[model samples]
Structures are given as structure tokens and as C-alpha cells.
Target chain A: MLTLVSRNSPAAPSGNRRRRSIEGGWKQITINRAFLLPAVVVFVFLFIIPLAQGFYWSLTDFTGYNPEANFIGMANYAEILRDPSMLSALAFTVLFAVGTTVIVTCLAIPLAVQLNKVFLGRNFVRSLWFFPAVPSMAILGLVWSYILSPLPSGVLNTTLNNWFGIDAVSWLSDNSLARMSVILVGVWAQVGWHAVLYVAYLQAIPTEYYEVAKIDGASARQQFFSITLPLLTPAMVISSFLLLTGGLKVFELPYTLTNGGPGFATNTITQALITSGVSQGRYGLASALAVMFTIVVAIVGFSQLKVTTMISRRFS
Target chain B: MKSRALRVLALAAGASLTFAVAGCGSGGADDGTTTVSFLSWTGQEQMEPMIEAFQEANPDVRIEASYAPPVAEYIQTLQTRVLSGTAPDVFVVAAENKTNLIQSGAVVDLTGEPFMEGVQSFNLDTYGSDGAQYGLSLSSWAAGYAYNEDMLAEVGYDGIPETWDEFLTMLQKLKDAGHTPFLESVDQMPTTVSAMLGAQTAQMDPAMDELIFSGESTFAEQWTPILEDYNQLYTEDLVSSDVVALDGDQVRDEFANERVAVINAGPWIINAVEEANPDLNWSFAQVPGRDGGMPFQAGAAAPGYAISANADEETQAAAKTFLTWLASEDGVQMFHEATNDVTVTDNFQPEVNPVFEPLVEPIREGELYLPMISWQRDEDRLNIEVVAQIQRMIQGAVSPEQVASALDSQLSGS
Candidate 1:
């Protein structure tokens, strides 16, 4: 007592037991790390190695067919900066990503609330909403291209003419209209799936909280703002993140619908990548564009995650 | 126990490694027959019969054929295989990849191969460079105006006119008779513009593209007039600017449904349009020229077969035998029956549909032009720029001069 003997003193039996426990813990840690080896190998080979190779290719004039590519540092980046079509592609890509994310979130939340209510043919209606999400964006785009065709014989235009006697509107011909139509169709295609995600989260909220709020004379709107909205923040984070990333990577819809046309009004960065890298054989230049696009996507993604995480923390 | 577990894992890994090593064995058999790997541009349905015929005729040479559909998928697949040194012994060399294949020395030159003889020179030159042929092109296709006979009859014109002025007049009459006059999908290089450029270039000694590419001329100087003339369809309100948003299939549908009078079409559309409307009377006509130019058609030779440069001498010889058989009269006939393509080989005359008869002569004579096929370099890049700028021109966002100037800038890489 006077010496304040440590538990690990060599003279004590408990010290020996502690030593054995430490040795067993080390062995367990070794086994755990061994279990992680395959995953680490896969990550390095697939993601890290390809990323490094792509970065190396970005600095060269590597026409896809040629193996002996000459190092032409920054020429490809400089070319991308000067190209107007590429710039237009960047602008439209950003527009589509932000537009679809904002619009789908706004509509999907309200739609989920409505779909949560008991109604006639509720399953049928839910299925109808989810149907668009079932088909590929490419197929949906083709079908909608016919529906949104600017001609008088188009499905929507014909309906409008027959019902309202209105002239055919150029849904995909005019620049602004084409951009808007693509974004709207994108929203329509995704809103239902995102709503289903919200519905799952909505169902998890306990009924006790709402009952207590009702007993306190809390208005429906106030209770919703305080309870439903706060708890839905987690779903918002997931849904918005998906919408943003998917929209940023969009290629098939605008490609099949307008083919990035009416003069680059609907061109996407992904389309530009394919056109340059695969179609034109300018792999180096495409790599540079891809590098820039990746940085942009990362920045946007991280910013969104940070904002959503802060919201979640505050709400929780 | 742990060591026993490790032993099991080691045994499994050893088994996997052995199987993978065995999988990398050579493509050969105990028999003396040589196997030639081929990547066909034609679809499997159309290519299988021809491959079967070749293997039957050449008992000693076997074609191990695979297919990727044209034009983008085939190009990308071939490019990847060539780069990886796993390319087929034989493959297609299309306009899209001809320059790359030649520059990288991935294709064998067939300049004076016996298989190259009797093929159309224009078709050969399409996939050649500096007097060396690299592809065995067997057929050609041309796109021209397919007009509705009944609609034209209603407008008091039996055929598309021979000049731009008359064509416009006919279009106006069709419009006044309550019909959509003309629709050429500007989604690509418009057939009208290509045919017009073909007419103008057909008269030049140095050739228009040669002059422009060699830096003796510029797109602004050679293309502005043609652009202005072609823009009249929109500016004069004979054709809708909305055609910028239309694809070939849409325009063809409009023609098939009897809503539009004329649409740019090739032999590929013959069956679909006929099936869509059996009662619709239609015939093809050359795209009219402008300002004292000959009537011309926008077309290119179909993608051609080429031997891979990386293949061994025996494999290459087998590849050549396959191509030679493909170019033979019987082979061409079999191919024509399978695909219904307009065959351009000297020995066999393809029997095309009656509605596609008018454009067949031009195809056979190789009197057709496609700018992408003829461009010396930067063909895809220039094609993209031109199509976009022309769309802008149709939208009235840019003038004809601006469209031509954009091409000039793109070519100069400014």
C-alpha cells in the first residue's frame, strides 16, 4: 500500500492473466486484418491502379490506338478549356444535376406524404408511379422523345390540339425548352423511386409522437414541420445524394432524346467524354476532361454531404 | 486446425491458377486446318451464313467469327482488341477507324492483293491512304430523297427536281397543297448538304477536301455558298427548322404515314417503309444540286474487311483466303441474299428492291460522296462540329457564314 503497487507488478497473479489477455487480443487483431486482405487487393487493383493510370494518360497525347503516346503536358487540358462545346456540355450537365435534385426532392417528399395515406387502388397507383423507374433511362427517353416531339403528330401535341385547339409547342426543338424538357422528364422518371424511399422512412416514425402532439392542440402543419420533416432528413441525404450523382453522370437520356443537339444545348459532360474518347479516338483529351469532371463531381458531392450531415445533426 | 484450413485454401488457389493457365492456350486443334479469328461488322444473323459458306468452300481454313454491330460498337471493340494485341486475325476497317488503324499500323495493306482487284476503286480508296488499300470493301450505299408518288402527283410533280430552285418550288407547292414539304434529319450531316458539297467537289481538279485539308483553301470559302443555299429550306419556310430535332427514323415514319412528301433515305429503309405502308407509292431520287452543279448522292462504301497486322503469316494467309472468298461472285450473292445490301463488286450485281432502284446506279458507279469518308484527318471531330453548327443555323441562332466559319476554326484548332 505504501509503495502504491501497480496492477501489472510481476509479483502478482493478475499480471500474468493480463499478459495472456493482451497476447490473445493481438492474435485476434492479426486474424481480422488477414480477413481484410482480399478486399484491399481488389480496391488497389480496380480503383487505385486505374485512377493512377488515367491520371498518367491525361498528361500524354495518347490516341487510343497508339501505345507509344508522347507526353504533351497540359495541352489536352488547355484544349478542353478552349472548346466551346465542352464548356456548353459542362453548363448543361451542372444544370441537369442541380435541377433534377432540387425538383425531385421537392416533389418526391410531397408525393410520399400523399402516397402514405390509405386510398382506393393504393397499390395500383403506387405501381403506376414506380413504373417509369423500372425501365432504363434510355428506353424512357426514347418513349418520351416521341411524346415530346415538336411535330403536330406527337402524342402530347396531338392531345393538346384535339382537346384545347393549341398549336404544337417545340418541346425539344427550342434551346431553353429542350433543356427544360430533359430536366422535367428526368424528374418524372426519378420522383417515384425517391418517394418510395421516403415512404419507407415515413413508416418508421412512431404514432405516439403524433398522438401527443394532437392532445396538445398542435396543428397538423406544425406537427409535420416539427416531427416528419426532421426525421425525414436522413432519407433526404440519401435520395439527394443519389439524384445528384446520377444526374451528373447522365448520358443516355439526352443522347437518345435530343442527341445533345439543337446545337449543344443539351450536351452532357459524359457525352463529350464518349464522343472524344471512344468515337474520336482522343483518349488523352477525354482523360483530361474526365479528370476535371471527376474533381467537379467530388467537390459537389462532398459539399452536399457536409451540408446534409450538418442538417442531420441539427435536426437529430 | 489453422494449418489445415490454410492447406485447403492453398489447394483451391492452386486449382484456380491451373485452370486459368490452361484457358490461355492457343486457338488450334490436332487437325491441320488453320483457324482465322474474325470480328464481323455485320450482325450475326447476316454473317453466319456467309461464314458457313466460306468454311464449306475452304475446308482447310476455318473462320472463327465474332460480331459487333456497326458503327460505334464495332469500332470501339476493334480498337480495344488491336491495342491489347488480342485483335482478331481479320476485322472490319470502317471510315470511323480507318485513319487510326492505318496510322498505328494495325491493319495490313491490301494495295495489290488479288482480293482487292475487281472491287470499286472509290470503295477501295475510302479505306486507303497514300495509294495503299487496307480494306476489302464489297458494297456501297447511297442516301437520296425518297418521295411519296401520290403526294407529288397531287402537287403536279412526278419526281424531285434537278436543281435547288425547282426543288424549292416543288416544296412550296407541296406545302400549299397542305403537306409537310421536306424533312432531312439534321441530326447528322444532312444528305442535302453532303450531296451539294459532293456536286461542287466533283468538278474540282484538286478535289474540295484535298484543297481544304492541304491549307490551300478553307471551309469558309468552299462551304458558305452551299450552306446558304441549303439554309433556304428553313429560311424560305419550305421545311421546318424542327427537323433539327428529328432523326432519320422519325422522318421516315412521317413519310411512311403519308404526312410528309420527302425524306432522306437509303436502301436500309426500303423494307421498313414498305411494311409500314404497303399502299404508299414511293421512289428514290438524287438530291438536287445548286448553282450549276451535278445531281449527287450522299453515300459511302460499307465497312470493309482487313487483315490484322499483328497476326502471324499463316494466320494472315488464312485471313486473306477468307476475304478473297467473301469478294467472290458466289460469296457476294450469298451476302446480298442474306443482307439485301447494294453489292458493289464487279462480278455480282445485287438485286435491290424496286423502290430503291433509282439510287442503285450511283451506288454501283461509286458516284457518291460522304464528307466523313473523304476527310483526310479529324473526320469525326469535324463531323460533330459541322452537324452542331448546322443545327444552330437551322435554329436561326447562327448564319450560314458563321456555320462555315466554325468549321474553319475547328479545322485550324483555334
Candidate 2:
């Protein structure tokens, strides 16, 4: 850390009393060198190293289990293009990612707006919403499985039968329904987190904009569209990007909920990767899959950032 | 240009190699004692007594234990450790990681260990490949219906049926008298496949599995009749597909609550029932087989110990000594008394749950199996696919034939 920090700091005005080189000395160099070196080392080590490794592995047969690997060229990339399970996982994953991101963003904005306003039991409600994220998803999944099981004896079905005379609902067993149920649970788990993010950013947007709009006879909805949405763009970008990446990498919730069952209805790419790679001892194939997955994720993530930034620019 | 570049390149390569070597040199030989780090796949309760006994017997050797909650977490934790080159000296090589553990050379072969003397042949074969033992298995666990005698008497049956047909007829009688006939945990592997195959494997020759996988026969050819026989529970509307959702603990609770007449279970579950409802009129029976077949069980040797491939000669010798002691008469008895498992050694036997007496002979005589542990390769994948297919079959999606064909395709592809 010390070595990294001292190599790229900004020049200090009069620290260099000694001059080894006549033109410019180590003192001036060290002053500027100190600050930038830390960032450079961190940036290189944490991001660049892993990214480079992933890219290199994508071009080879690096099964995660084995030490020795061979260059397989683009066979991994070509295989991913044809694999059906990977494609299905991708489709459902995108549906889940996009659906949760949009729904959570819309719901959270209003939720944050309302939450910020003083209410009789605002703190209590805040805790209730945020508590979904507290319990491990695995436990919550088991609880929800009992609640949504497709049999008459299931908890939800029994309640519905006595109260409303409705039959059982198979939330996870059916294909389309399982896809939708996963997205709903994803939204339920994350809305509070994104809402809190919005709440933080909401405090920063000047209250004067709303007050000035009211004086100009602008309606509440108009004021929100013109003033609030523009200022909230950066937060929106940050939250949705988080949702995108996190959603793509999710393994536990779907795994616990359905174990990628009803014939791969709720399977995720990560689950497939772990299943095929670690469990099946196809490490080289799994590594190839992982490297390719990392690339696709990076590509999608950066493009989304660019699109969001452009949209933010338009709104502002 | 070449001379100037060469000078800088040489310095850079030297510096990088120095850094790499420094990281590699961090691990070296320990002091006198060999520190064996093990991952206990079983939870603390089941493992504590055996571990304590092992520790008491070998005070010089120290064993550090970590745990993952169950199957999934155990596999993941081990994978992470093995990948990072930090796996335990002695850990479980259960059915879950049998293939990968052997395939990648993650576990050491126990072909000539002294501890294996007089150990059950079933235990050896369960963890072995090509007739070479890799694990020193301690006990076998069989799962079947834990029947309530009162309920069967309510439906007018003195004991478990001998044939698959009669078992269904008994379940029919129970349902006719307003009893929930059964509950099985599809979330965990059910004993249905075990009972169906376990018996056949015991009677058949060793060359059979190789022939079956070589496309000489099919699972449908053998198992369709069993599934059709078992499907009577669902076809007759005696049990529900609700089981596809519930796990062992929930099903156990149902049995505890006395709402259900039967539950698919193992000896591991005896304590839960004893604690929950002591007065319940329950006893286990082997699953009824096709054409009055020999009663078979879905069971295997519990996780066995393995020496680390990375250990030095002295540590390896010390580990071998520990393993030999563990299999000794005193050690086996201590382990069995603590675990209450039906150990297969002829040297010692611990008094276990009273209901287990009927099963002790078969377990010790090596007449049980676990399907995942019995496969030649891709055991985990095949098990997962089979369970999912069974779930689908119950849900009315695929037939028994399709399930078998799917497995054959998977086998062919790999």
C-alpha cells in the first residue's frame, strides 16, 4: 500500500529540498506519485487482472477444477452459441433482470417519495419493507415454497380454500408461472434496497425546485417529470446497474425455490455453470462458460451504463 | 534497441518471479503434529461424538473441523477450498463428490490401508472404482416407509406387505379409511429408486452395470415396471404431488403431528420421532418389491476418511496410524455408540435404535445401496435428472420411458 501510494501523488509546493536530477527531482515526482499510485494499483489488481484472466481463459479450455489448461481457441464461445440450456437460462435471466429492474425502479421511486414524507408509522413500515432482504434467501425460499406449493394441503391453498374457495396454485411447477414467480420474488427482495438508495438521493435534490415549480403554477405530476426525474437519473442508473449485474449472477434464490426444476423452468446461468463445472467435473467447459459469461455481462453492463448516461443527459 | 530492451525485460521478469516465489513459499512443513483439517458434511450433532472419540484416541494428532449446512453448501465449500489449494487433510468423499474427487485425484487411494482390514465389502465398493478402495466407510443408511402399526391395523394389515402390489392395496385401504397414505421428499432423493435397484444389484453380477450403460439394456426396461407399480399411489389418488415440494424435515413434522400414516425415512430420523412423539406406533419395513422380490434398501456407507495427497511421509504415516486406530475394534465401537449407525465391521457392533434391529443384518451383511453412489460416472448429474424426471412423471409431463431415454442420451453424450 505504501509503495503503491507514494509512486503517483501530486507535486507538493516546497517538499523537495534535495535534487538528485538537475531538471526535476524525486521529491516532486514522489509528491505527485504518492496519490495516483494507490488508485493505479487498486485499479490494476482488482479489475484489470481478473478481466485479463477471464478474457484469456475464454480463448482456452480452462475447466475451473484443473490446474493445467490448453488453448482451445474459440471453441468455448462457439459452444455457448449453440447450447440450449445456456440459451434458456439467458432468456429467463434477461426477463428476470429487466422485469425486476424496471418494476423495482418504478415502485421504489414512489415508495421512496412516500417514505420520505412524515407519517404516523413511517419507521415501522420502513422496517417491514426492508426486512425481506435481512433473512438469508435460502430460508425465505423454503418458506415461500411451502406457501406456494401446488397441492391442496399447502398453506396458501388451505387458506384460499376456506376463505375464498379457490383451488391450489403451483407457483413454481409450471414454466411461465415459475418465471413470473421468480421475478416477483426478486422484486420483493430488492425494492426496499433500491428505495433506500432513492431516498438518499431524494434528500440531495434541492427542495427549492419543487417550491419554485409550485409558485409557477406547475402541477405536482408536471413538476415531478420536469424537476425530480432529471435529478434522480444518476441514482436510477446506479441502482438499475446494480440490479442488472446482481440479477445476472443470482444462484441461491432460484436454487432453493425450485432447484432448477419442473425441467429447467427456473434455472439460472450460474446454476448451470456450477452444476456442469463443479458437480460434473467438466471444469474446463465450465471455465470456458464462465469466461464467455463474464464477457457478455461486461458488454451488456457497459452498454447499459452508456444508454443510461445518455438518457440522464437528455433528462437533465 | 535490442540491448536496451533486453536489460529492462530481464529485471522485470526477475522481479515478477521473486514475488510469485514469495507467495508459493508461504506453506511449509509444520512442527511435530500433523494438522488435519476436515469438512464435516453432516451437521454438528451427528459428527461431534465420533470426532470426540477420534480426538480422545489420538491426542498427538489434531483435527480441525468445518461444516456446511448440508449437501449443497458442503459441495460448494469443498469446491472453493480445493480450487484454492486449501482443502482439508481428511474430509468426506461422499456420493456427492465421488466422481469429481476420483476424476481430479482430489482424494488419496486407500487400496492397502491397515484400517480397511475387516471393513465391510459394501463400504469399500461404494467408494471404490476398478476394484480399488478409496474410502473406509463406517455405516450404511437405508430409507423406507416408517409405518404406524395402529394405522395399518386400522386399515387391517398386521405388517408391511411383501409385494409392491399388496403395498398399494394396503395404501388403498388406508385411503379408503380416510388416511393420508404416504409422504416422500422429492427435494431429497427418495428411496424408491434405491429399493428398486438396490435389491437387483445385490443379486446381479458385477459386470451388469457396465453392460446396462453400454446400451445392452435400459432403465425403462428394468425400472418402468417399478415406476408403474409405485405410480399406483398417485394414480389411485392416495398420495399427492405435494411431495415434490416438501423436504425431509417437513415430512417428518407431518409424521410427528400424526396427520400422515406413513413417511419415507431412514434410521437417521429415529431420534426426531422419539423426541417428538414417543407414543407413535411406528416401525420401518423394506420397500415392497416387484414379483415379491428380495427386500432391498437405499443406503450407503456414511462419509469415510481419506489421507491428503499433499502430506509428507511422516504426516502420511501418522495419518495412516490414525486411520488404523479408527477402524480398530475399540474405535469402531466408540464411533458406532456415538453415531448409533449400523457399522459393518465384524469386530464390534453398537446397540442402536430398537426399530433398526430388523435392518442391522442387511446393513452389516452389505445388502443396501444408494443410487448416486453406485453409478460408474456422472453420479450427481444422473441423480438430479432422475429425480426431476420422476417429479415430471408425477406431474403428468413425461412417461417412464422418456426418463430412461433421457439418461441414456446423457450417458451417450458424455
Candidate 3:
């Protein structure tokens, strides 16, 4: 309504005139600003403001409950760094972030390529792959908990025991195995959704490029490397950033799977922040951890954003 | 055209955001009849009948309830809701939130509310502070080792030992017979400390809590011996530190399905055990402690209804009416029948699952005291520390005394 009203009046024409005047020297700024206004609004309101609030809280010892909190400077950061559990959770979180990003990217591309082809029950296959991401993590966790139970009576273990004549494996008990199992489950839950994402982007690539390469007597592999790979770089940048942040901020799956232990083996930074801040009533400490975590996350996120843009620009 | 394509992409992303936010902001309440979102930690199947009873009783109060499993998830979900001001009018505030729930003004403080009439003091005190009750606790639970009777016979022990020393000796005998003696999940803090503390409370002129909180003695002074005594199983190689890596559910699963003689468990898991291994020989017993000490339990009061302080007098009264009915004979029976809890009210003697009978008395009689439950300070913080320190203790990374001392330091730190 406001936009319509403004457009209908003569006053906005002068505003547009001012814009045109500035467009000579600041033309790119006007263009970029116009193009990005809607997205900027969304990113600022939903993401930026909340992140700023979170960062501010991190600086203060903002116990989640108290209406009043005091600024404790870098005390929270100092404590979190010194604390062993948070460090362990951070280490595991990084491993998980890197592991899933590398593994899922490799898996999803191939999986998307296969699904994009005409095959028997192709739709059915696609749905089956996508099914894990459909359910809430809580439900999936309950189901997977039983399946990954360390006992011989556990679903997978019992099946493996009978079918393969093997002993029961403690999928969630041993520290390293628990970490691996959590990562494996994470990949299982997410890879399909990501594959579907790649599928959507994959369909967007022009067939003319592939055809042109074929017309040049290029083999399928040659065409993929010369044409398809370069085009997919933009999508890769987007997908990898999502995966990195998603994996870093992962809480539900690991919490559901292991509750951050055998002994803090599979804990994540967010989980530690939450468990300490909310459950323990150390909101101030928690907010501090959160604030610091946000800074770290922002640093990582911005660096990845820069790297992805560069890669995409190189491809362009 | 490029901008149009970007717009299409943006719209798609926005649509997915709608989907994502929709999933969380609303938790799948489809029947959609003025849904009163009830957040429970109870299992889904267990809540069905109780919900049915509520619907039957108050047809106007169209209820929509969902449960996060238990402990951490339940706490996390409630925290999110409360912090975001999206919490249900009614929600479970177990021991983990007993302090913060009250201090944060998240729960209703029913100091002299009408719904509290005829409610037992033990249940009230479970979720209460000095004089004000925050929750209308409906049930109480006491967990101990669920033992195999036949295994006791094989080890030449007729039943669970009455004394802590006797228990250790019995464990040694079981080890001698080449069986895994006993397994308690150290992924949680030691239940025996709570049971022993409860025992001490029963004998105390004032209480263990009073003395400990008054600084008469520290946790290290009180619990070090108990932890060391408990560690006899590890030191003697009757059981490995493997148990420390396991939680209550895993322990219960092992006891139900494995050849292990005993598993640390509570009444909540009886149904799963019955369904899985109905023929398994099992019965509950109080965890043994120093012989002269009172046979105390390691249980907590069940989550109950709390009147929202923000609600108007009319809504508060209406909510009170509902809660009062829940504590009444019919309501108690209905809820107990559904949840299979050890409901502690003189008004109702619920026909619980037979396996839970052994725990019923201890739970009802108010014969339990866990240190975390009794902590004058932050319960969740101390509990997490204890659980971690205990895990390290069992892993041979730290000594039992060190674990006790760590608790003391953690308690004193903040």
C-alpha cells in the first residue's frame, strides 16, 4: 500500500530523480541496494538482529532467567575456554562439521546424478532417500536409539549378529565408535535432503552445454569436468556453507543419540552452551558462551562466504 | 529475467523457512480444537489414556499434548518455550528446574491454592521450596537394582544384602562365580549416595540437607566413603568402568535382555522389560547402604500441575479445578492407570503393573533423598558435575575422593 501510494504521487518521482542523479557516480550502489533491499530486510530482521542480540548477551553474564544481568566482560569466554567439556564439545563439533561437509558433498553429487537419470521407480527411490529428513529429529532419534543400542538385542546388532555371525558391536558405548555412529547417523539423516537440493540445482544446468561438449566429441567424464563441474560451483558454495553452519550448530541429533557422552565424547558447542545456560541456571555464563560462540561462528561463516563467492566468481 | 530467476529462488527459500518455522512454532496439533499445548516428558503411548480421560472430564478443554522423551530434551524444550514466551500454560518442571522454575517466575507458586488441598506433603515438598509449592506433584519414584532371583541363588545369596559391606561381599561372590556382579550407570550420579542420604535423613533429628547446607561438613566428607565403597566393584574387577558410559535406559535394556544379573533401574521401565523378556526373573530392592542407616530411596516427586501466575482469577480457578480433580480419587486412578506411576495418595491405590509393587511402598512413604534433589544450590549444575566426575572416576581417570572433592569445589565455586 505504501509503495503503491508513493508511486502514485509526484513526490516519489523526485526521489527517483535523486536516485538517477546519484546513479552516475554511485550507479552500482543504487543497483545493488535496489536489488538487495528485500533480502537485506529479511537477513537483517531475522538473522542479523537476533545474532546481534545473541552477541550482546554473550558479553554479559545474562542468565537466561533474570530480568536483570550484569556485564562480566570476557569472564564467560575465559571460563568456557578453560572448561574441558566445552572444549571437547567444540573439537567434536568441528570434526562433525568437516566430516559431514566433505562426506555429504561427495555422496550427494553422485546421488543427485543418479536420481536425475531416468530409472526404475525413480520417484520412489527419490522419496526413500528423502524420507529420513522428513521426520522430526526427536522421532528419528528414538527410532535410531533403539537401532544403535549397544546390546546384542539392539536391532542392528541383533540383525548383524544373526545374519553375519558376528558379535554385538557397541555402537554408542565406546567413545570413538559413539562419535562415528553419531556422524554416520547425521550423514544418514541429512544427505538425502541435500541430495534433493543438488537435484533441484542440477536440473537448472542447461543441457545445451552438455550437448555442445558431446558435439565436440567429448566423453561423458570430459563433459562433466569441463562444463558441469564449473557450473555446479555456485551451488557447491551455497550447499557447503549451509552444511558447515548446520553441522557446527547441530544439537538435537547428537543429544538424542548420546546425550553428549559416554563422557562428553559427542557434545557440541551449542549443546554445551544450552545445557550450562538453561539447565544449570548459569544464564550469564551461558550467554557469554553463546556470544563468544556467535563471534567464532560469524568469523567462520563470513570466511566461507568469501571463499564461496571467489570460487563462484572464478567459475563465472 | 535473471532477477526473476533469483526472485523464484528467494521465494522457494522463503517457503522452506515458512515450513521450518511452522514445524517448531506449532508441534503437529492437527485435531485443532482450541489446542491447549501441554508439554510432557512422559512417553507418547503412556499419555494417550490420561489425555482421553482429561477430554472426557472436560470436553470444553480441548487438549493437545506432546512429549519430549525425558531429562535433557524435556528440559531443553521447556527452556526454549519459557525463554521465548511460547511455553504451554501447563508443563512439567522436574527436579532439574525446581530452582530456576521458581526463581525465574516461570511456574505458578501455589502457596495456599485451592488445588493443593488434600495433597500429601511429601509430593508437595518434592516440587516445593521453604513453604511455597510450585508444582502439584502427583507421583513419586524410587529406583534401585532390579535383580534376578536365580542369580542370587547361584551366588549363594538368598536376596539383596541389607548392609553396604554385605552387598560388596555378595558382589565379590558373584565375581568369584564368574558373572558380572552388578552394574549401575555412572553416566548418572550415583543413586546410592541419594539412597544413603535419604537413609541418613530418616535418622537425622533435623536432616542431612540441613547439616550439609549449614557447612557442618562438605560433600567430600559425607559421600567419599560411600563412593569408595561403591567403587569396590570396579577395584575388585567385578565390573569394568564400562558401566559409567551407560545411562539408565541402556542399563535397563541390558538387564532385560542380557545375561547380566542386575541392572540399575526404576519402575518406569517395567513395561518395556515385561514386553521384551517377560520370563526374566526380576524384582526390585532398595540399594543397600551402611547397615545402621535407614533404608532410603533414590526417587523424585513426579511432575505435576502448576497454576500460571499470569492467569486471571477465573482462569486460575478453572485451572485449579482441573488440578484438584487430578489429585482426587478418580483423577489419580486415571493418570496412574495410564502412566503406571507409584502415585502417593491415600485417596487412590492404583492397580499398577505387578513389577512396580516393590517400589510403591518406598516411593509412597517418602523414603528417598538424592543429593542433587536436596542441593541448596543449583541442582542441574551440581548433578552434571557429579555425573561427569563420577564418569571420570569410573574410567580410572580420577579417584572417588577426587570426584567428591570436585563436587565440593563445584558447589563452592559459584
TM-score list, all predictions: 0.94, 0.85, 0.77
For A9-38, candidate 1 gives per-residue lDDT tens digits of 456558779898878799798998999999
Question: In model 2, where do residues sit more than 4 Å from their true spots?
Answer: A1-34, A51-66, A70-83, A151-153, A215-218, B1-88, B103-108
Task: For candidate 3, give the docking quality class from DockQ.
Answer: acceptable
True contacts kept of 2: 0.35
Candidate 3 lDDT, A31-73, residue by residue in tens: 7789988998999999889877776776776656555768877
Per-residue C-alpha lDDT of model 2 across residues B1-414, encoded as one tens digit per residue: 999999999999999999876533212235445555667766787667766777787776666677887566677777777767877666677787776677678778899776897888879888888778788887777777788889899988977887878888888889888888888888756787678777776667754466567677766676676677666667778788667666787788778768788788888788998899999888888877777687776777887777667666665666676678778887788777766778888788668777766677777887777767777777777776788777777777777677777777656655
lDDT of 3 by residue, B1-414 (tens): 999999999999999999877655422235442335577777888777777877787765555577898776787777777777777666776777777778777777887876577666777887887788888888877887788878889978767887887888888887778776787877676677667767767777767667777789887887787778777777777776666546677777777775578667887778888888989877888877685564556887777676545444544554565677777788888778777777888888767666657777777777777777777777787788778777666667788899888877776666
Q: lDDT per residue, candidate 2, A1-316, as tens digits? A: 0010123677765635433363466677788779899999999999889767767766766545456678878777676666656677777677777788889998999898888788899989888888898888788777877777765666877899999999877766677777777788889898998888898888887777777778878998987787777778989999999999988888888888877766666778898888877676665566667776777788879988999989976775
* Two-chain DockQ for each candidate model: 0.67, 0.28, 0.24
DockQ of 1: 0.67
What pairs collide in candidate 1?
none
Q: Global CA lDDT of candidate 2, please?
A: 0.76
> Chain B alone, TM-score of each model?
0.94, 0.87, 0.84
The list of candidate 1 runs beyond 4 A from truth reads A1-24, B1-29
Return the candidate ranking by TM-score, descending.
1, 2, 3
Q: B341-396, model 1: which lDDT tens digit per residue?
A: 88898999888888888999999999999999999988999999999999999999
